[model samples]
Target: MDRTELFLAIIAYTLIVQTFGGKAEGAMLPLFVLLFALPIYVVVHLYRNPSLE
Candidate 1:
């Protein structure tokens, strides 16, 4: 996905996490880190893919 799509995914995931897991579980550092890093990984993956436009 592109950055905008990834960002929206993160937002939706946050909402889902908060709705189901509630406040305390939603603040877990690991989850937050993964959420933030997702876009970085996407960018890196695109850069590394020689075939992509």
Candidate 2:
């Protein structure tokens, strides 16, 4: 339920959906958004809260 765990869960879910759903083409946009957004969120969060890092 912590941030790291939540992040990992999101990654795992995305991979599972992409792999098992057999619709990579359709899922690409969402997958890409998740992949890109997560890192950006982390970076902005860290930048805003240096104490967290």
Give each prediction's root-mean-square deviation over alpha carbons: 4.8, 2.6
lDDT tens per residue, model 1, 17-40: 777885657445545776789788
Q: Once all C-alphas are superposed, what RMSD does model 2 give against the true structure?
A: 2.6
lDDT of 2 by residue, 1-53 (tens): 89678767767777777889976666566557777988999889889898863
lDDT of 2: 0.76
lDDT of 1: 0.71
Q: What's the distance in Å from true for residue 7, model 2? A: 6.2
Q: Residue pairs in steric clash, candidate 2?
A: none
Error of 1 at 13 (Å): 0.6
Choose the strongest candidate by TM-score.
Answer: 2
lDDT top scorer? 2
The residue-level lDDT of candidate 1 at 9 comes to 71
